[model samples]
Target chain A: MDNIVTHAPDFFSNSQAEATKAIARSLWNRVLTSVCVALSLLTLVPLVSIIYLVLKNGLPLLSWSVFTQLPPAAGMVGGGFGNAVIGTIVMVGIGLLMSGPLGILSAIYINEYAPASRLAQAVRIVAKLLTGIPSIICGVFAFAIVVSTTGRFSAFAGGVALAVLMLPTILLTSEQALMGVQSAFREASYGLGATKFQTIVRIVLPDALPAIMTGIMLAVARAAGETAPLIFTALFSQFWAKSLSEPTASLSVLIYNFSTVPFPHQIQMAWTASLVLVAFVTLANITAQLVFSKKH
Target chain B: MTEDAARSSATQTPGRPDFLTVRNFDFFYGKKQALFDINMDIPEKRVTAFIGPSGCGKSTLLRNFNRMNELIEGVHYSGDIKLLGQSIYNKEVEVIALRRSIGMVFQKSNPFPKSIYENIVYGLRISGEKKKSVLDEAVERSLRGAALWDEVKDRLHESALGLSGGQMQRLCIARAIANRPKVLLMDEPCSALDPIATVKVEELIHELKQEFTIVIVTHNMQQATRCSDKTAFFYLGKLIEYAETQKIFSNPGQKQTEDYITGRFG
Candidate 1:
């Protein structure tokens, strides 16, 4: 013990140098931390400012009449894009109906049935490429296919446009969700003598359902907010759509039309429509989060 | 009654009949060979244990019994594995039907995210048995067969995931046996369990051998001694020795088997 005490003084003498090194490291850590915090706050600026601006300008025009009444003539007052809101909902619903089952079933075939096949690999590459295509091209494609054949713009054409855009999102996300299901579950099912179809339907799909729902909800939000595709397909209708085959008004198209017109009341209505669209997207996102959290 | 009499009289010992016979079996995963030429006759109504180090091909052989390895992209085998007198790899043999008659339990406990009752009756449901009374009876019987009915009876309607790890493993056993398969393949069933749970599973294995032909792959040498009637020791994808469990542990024929059991080296 006495021999150890003689060496302890040397250990204490180097403590000052160790303290200096620690201070230098901590200063660098603090500087990096501040820079990250500053950058992250900067990213939030656009989102927060948009929300603040929309609420400030849009709140005064938001009323029951805005939801109930139809759009008035140019330079007139006291009207709402009620038909446009309904048209958006109907068109997105139609797109979901068209694409939801197709995407999910194809994903199941790709992930569970033919995961390693060359054809499945090719399909996956094409689906990824489709996601990066410009939205306006989808509008043009639908115009060529649906509008030219039907002889007029219609909600059905708008739905086709939206479905094309939503397909890649749903397919890729569902594929990822299916892949994320642990292989242990499938192995256990197969061990118990389940057929491949039975194992996929009973064990794999139910396990991946929540994640698939989240993907669908995200696609729904994106489809609802799209503007360019609706313009070339659905076009704009001053009156409510009488049928799916007729021209339809949508909130995105209304905002596009009304925001640029030389009238004060129409401009205010556009801001109110923007707020409603944002709310719809927010609600869909919240639903997705809720569904995902319930699984845990 | 006459068939039963003839079958009983054919074998002098209770567990002497060859239930599963493997001859010159070689297994490969893609280009990599996982098991060398192997031969063994696993007896009916007896527990056979495979003991080896990691990557020694014990688990691979166990999976081949039910053809579970076919789930991989590129796995192939040579020679043949026969259940009863029929080759399981025959062209006409449906792989699904072959698997139905031979059940399996994995090393890690994996109960589906479902009610305990549904988990146990999963096999029956897939086989098209939907009568409520029959399903309820099977659930009770299988859980009792696994010695887990008493602890989980009241919670049969609850999610199987809520159970402890040991309970979940026992649940898996119940599910495997729900179809009343002729053979049960267990791959290191108690490796993830504690000592107490291991003892429970080992005891269950002892009781299970009276009805099902069991083939187990385990790294625990003591477990083989405790629960198995026959033991096969392997090293480097080759079967080093096969004998009665008593003889293998007390008087191993090969130097490698002795070195492995005595902790000289794996």
Candidate 2:
């Protein structure tokens, strides 16, 4: 009671009250700051350990042959995984070709053309649901559609599966990026006598390009590492991919398959393949930030 | 500019031919009506200011001239708004061509996040003006028209986002006038500007009136008096009184108009 009475007038002035408040704020800040820092450090542990293991196990196996030859037979160790690298690129390229335009256009329609309509709302909800569905389910879907019809596993089927997995991510992220564009810009464009199509094509899309590219890169990176979809759709091949109609090799599926084999050489190659997959994903993200951000 | 002289002059001015006319206009957003039974005539090559408190439908009436309010979904209107004696709402009149003749500036400074030069020529480019020399000349002319050329001429290619708030607003004005529209609608163009910037914009408005018909919506009573030739006071989405700028400020005929201008109540 005495302390409260002593500080009453100073409280109105806020000088005396502010000093105590500052001290308490500093204490709370220190505690919360340490807690957040500790949580961040904890989050880094899994990522650091994964990198350490990949580097430790895969560095000795790295060679020029890794990019130039086919994988060796079960117990032998002289060849490399040029086939898987090319197959991964081809599948991912096809996935991008199929999903990129479709996803971006759908996002544009949802955001710009019919944002508040029931159809757009339905598309948005389904896109969200698609993202949450398991990757294996996407593989099963592609298998049911393409593999069952063709009676064989092919890179085309794998690409379709991967594209299905990428579609929801690209759609969601592109919608968010396009929506981030200020309504003022749209109004300005409209005020200047530009048609809706002209405004979207010339102003809205260009402004959202950097963010849209980031979304595409992230989607592609996720598609590149997908293992379940490719296993069901592409199956596996030891030879270089000759056509989109044939079974194709991929880094993720190869790692999953070879890591389980009893042979020592195949297991070592699995680690190398995992390292390469990680490198590809990292390079994709880096290039996206570097290249697209420059335009902004 | 005296009170009695201004009243007679405004009363006689109503006989002049109107450039834009709104007749028994009613506007709605979905089921809720926002404007009710508004009728007014804006003269050519003159600054007609709409002064009212917030949500009084001043901006709504301005937007009708260019059909900008149609951009919002579920907004419908019942009225005939004629631009140069032709009904703008007619199905025969294309919205793009209508907008090309009537440019607008928003209350907020919304310069595109592009370069200064690109911002000015955006309208022209969309209309298929591709000659570099033509675009370059338009850039200088529009910037000069908006009184922004001197400050921005050195960095025409720099991002407009790098400009100051006042500069950005001026850039928007430059962009709007680049199309050389017959009528210009400014929705509180100086509301977001500082006093100095506000004065500069008012000066620009005075000069622009010689070339284009201007309808301004403003909350600032002094701005309406300073910049507008004819002043219309709106209250509760109704036009209470409109007269010469001098008469509206000095001696309003309606109690509501007098109360609003004197700050007794909004």
Candidate 3:
């Protein structure tokens, strides 16, 4: 009773009442933060495991020759990913070329110029719907329109399919980036006697640059690893690419083809190719983050 | 100056036959009325400030000067706003061209993420100035007019985003004046700034009125007192008081105006 009385008197003390409340509030916040932190970290374990395994499988087959050689054969010894690397680069570049400007212009219209008109609303709805369309569905649509029309698989058709797949994401992200810019900036430009187009071109675009770049990079990475669209477009090429207008090979398709083959060498090559594609994607992600964030 | 050009501001002002006149103005954002039955005159080559509490239509009135409110979705208005005697809202008028003749500055210092020189010349280039020497001269003149020349002349090529908050505000002012617009509108141009920066901006405002008809919307009563030649106090989209600066400060005619100035209520 004596101990309780001493402690109880302090608890009831006027000077400490506010302090007790503050400490309890902080404790509640800390507990809530810990639960959220733990839940997110737990979800990341499997992702880390997959990357680690891919890296482990890839390290042995990767070499200067792996970069330079063609696929060895069904049962043969040595082949490299040079052709696949070039094909991926060219295809992605072409896809970006086709989609980037349209996406940016469309985003500008939606975010800046649109006045809630029926046409504007319809365009937005269509873009939203397009974003949800499956990559396989895009592939099938391209195969029907392109493969049957051209009567052959070609990199041009693959590029077109990839462009279609990439456009919606680019449009959505670009719109978000444009919208993310504070209206104050636009108003500031207008205040400075700039035309609306000038304000968008000069002030708004530059401010939203880092975010827009991030979106473009996301599109690029997604395009780089896409296989379904490529299968309908890019055929199995063992030889070097003569032109982008014709047939070619890519990492995703090569990996898919080799991974299903009966030979150990081809299987190893598939792992190597997958590793390379994963690395390219990782490098793109890291580059975007590092260049944008000054914290690190 | 020609004798004809040296006559009344009405005859002399480029493109403006007289003052800024808002006649029978009504504003709607689709169906909701934001401004109604507004009538006022902003004199040429003078400073007129719009003062009101939040949501009292101060900023909306400022934007009406340049038709910026048109950028918003569902905003509709019926008014005749004549800038220098030119009917600004005429269907035949090009909004982009009209905006070029009237400059604007915001509460937040919004410098482009570009070089100081580029920020200044953005408007000129947009209006189609391609000569390098001319652009350079205009950049210097604008910076000088904005009271920023001495500070930025050595670093015109440097990114404007690197400047201090006050410097960025001045850079925006420089950009606005580079095109030599006949009128300038400021929307609480220094609310985000420190006291020192606010004073600098106020001084700039005083200097700017000599060449441009300046209209500002300010939350700070002191800013209106220090820099304005004429004060227009707005309440619920109505012009409650419009008079000489000194008179409005010393003897306001309305109870609401007095309360706002004295901080009795926002």
Candidate 4:
């Protein structure tokens, strides 16, 4: 087959003009490739610098006391953000619990049950709009809802704000995940005598589980690091929370309040809390990857 | 059944029962017509294959049997289809129940991204069968029915997606039969398989007809001739010819059917 093959005279042997043009084109391609590679690396600079700065300032304050002791008052030097860490965990946990089911169910309704209707379209638009809404506005909205009702800044209020912030991310990611599932799986389920709901719950959900989980983990991580919402709802507490109605000391809020203070010790503790927040978010992401990779 | 004998016999004799009857059935995808004025009776406990060129609506007609076409948006149909002398399109008929009695396997093998055991027992589990022993037995029975028991017996707990293409298709067959459907519709089930897997699935279909009324749509003429008890030749949304498989292959009554069988035109 190779022996019988023929080539155009100009294909194997180019004229001087064509050869010069090809060389110029190849040089242009090399320049373009290098530019693209440089631009991609340039985008990572901000994130790498942020991590570096946080680790540089925060690692010095990482002692056992940070986990065991409470935030000290003005002029104190050696205290930890124990209450803030616990508070961040509780509020984010509450937010996840609230958003997970609602987001997943809405995604199912949009992707499986009512995909063609105007209502689903409207819902999808609203979800996209919600994701674009600033986190501070979510705080204000939660502040209006919870503070007007209960007359206090509380961990529950913080949770409500975070849940609001998390819902759209969860909904959008989960919807995309559910959409990623192959139609064949749903068809197979329906072919086997399963109802629409049965097909969704049994086959579609399981198939999209990895992606859905990644979405939920992303939402949790986003919720954990959010400071603006906590400022309005959780406020700041120097002590551990005694009840859901009391002001909570989440890590993000603690960092926000302490970083602004004149005390050097409080600023040092704020950097430490920032590092812990990054570590917490990183852990959630890693867990999501692990769950996503596990075979069903 | 010899071609001469089956052709001489024809179809729908005075005494023989028709398990499924389609009368002047027409189907549409939005404004476009897919199946036009189809009329036939499918016998019970036999393999009926629909052969046609691509997009000739053989698969559409098969999907109409269990209302699977309704899953697609903008699809509508007219005329009545009956199962066991009762209208299937009646308002009183629940589609879920209808599908339970009529399983389907697609051209592509689709197994749940789950364990082999879970894939087989999915139908039973959805129907509220919670007994461990019963589920375990069903897994074995269904896998055996699809002729995949020996290959996957040791690794029943393994992921169905991990199986080879042929094994995955067989697992889908096993999943379908686990529901013990009265009718099984296969839409070009072997189109993606290699010749060896195709032969295996063809043999499985032959054995499956003993327990289920099997309807298949295929592009492969040899496959239609090899396994089908009845063959319906479709052309451009019309049923050109339908008769015993032997007659359709050897002595097609219609000129078009003969032309198609002889590779004159699609």
Candidate 2 per-residue C-alpha lDDT over B1-266 given as tens digits, one digit per residue, 9 for 90 to 100: 86447435644454345789989999998998888898888888789999988998899889888999999888998878998799999899999989988999999999887899999999999999999999999999999999999998999999998998888888998999999888899999998899999999999999888677889999998899899999999877788888888998898888898999999988
Q: Per-residue lDDT for A1-296 in model 3, tens only?
A: 55564456444545566558767888999999999999999999999988888888887899989878787778988878788888888888888998999898888888888637676688788989998888877777877888889888878878888899989889889989998988877776665556768788887787777788788899999999999889888776998889876778899999999999999888888888988998998898899878874220
The better-scoring model by DockQ among 1 and 2 is 1
Model 4, span B127-194: residue lDDT tens: 99999999999999999999999999999999898899999999999999888887899999999999
Residue B160: error of model 4 in Å? 1.1
Worst 10 residues of 1 chain A by lDDT: A5-14
Clashing pairs in 2: none
DockQ of each: 0.69, 0.65, 0.45, 0.71
Model 1: how far residue A200 lies from native, Å: 1.3
Q: What is the C-alpha lDDT of each candidate?
A: 0.91, 0.90, 0.84, 0.89
- lDDT, residue A257, candidate 3: 93
lDDT of 3 by residue, B1-266 (tens): 75335434543544342478999998988898888888887887788988888988889888888888977778988878897677998887777777777888877887767789888998888778999999999999999999999998899998888899999999888888887777898988899899998899899998887677899999888889999988988888787888998888899999988888889898
For residues B1-266, write the lDDT of model 1, one tens digit per residue.
Answer: 67456445534457656789999999999999999999999999899999988989999999999999999988999989999889999987788788878999999999998899999999999989999999999999999999999999998999999998999999999999888888999999999999999999999998888778899999998899999999999888888899999999999999999999999987
Question: Per-prediction TM-score, chain A only?
Answer: 0.93, 0.92, 0.87, 0.94
Q: Write the per-residue lDDT of candidate 2 for residues A150-180, one digit (tens) a residue.
A: 9999999999999999999999999999999
- Model 2 bad stretches (over 4 Å): A1-28, A294-296, B1-16
Show model 4 residue runs off by greater than 4 Å: A1-22, A294-296, B1-17
Instruction: Give model 4's docking category.
Output: medium
| Model 2 CA lDDT for position B233 | 90
**Arrange candidates by lDDT, highest first: which order?**
1, 2, 4, 3
Question: Candidate 1's residue-wise lDDT over A1-296, tens digit each?
Answer: 64564456443434676556667888999999999999999999999999998898888999988878899899999989899999999999989998899899989999999988998898799889999999899899999999999899999999999999999899999999999999999999998888989998999998898889888988898899899999999998989889999999999999999999999999999999999999988987897788665442
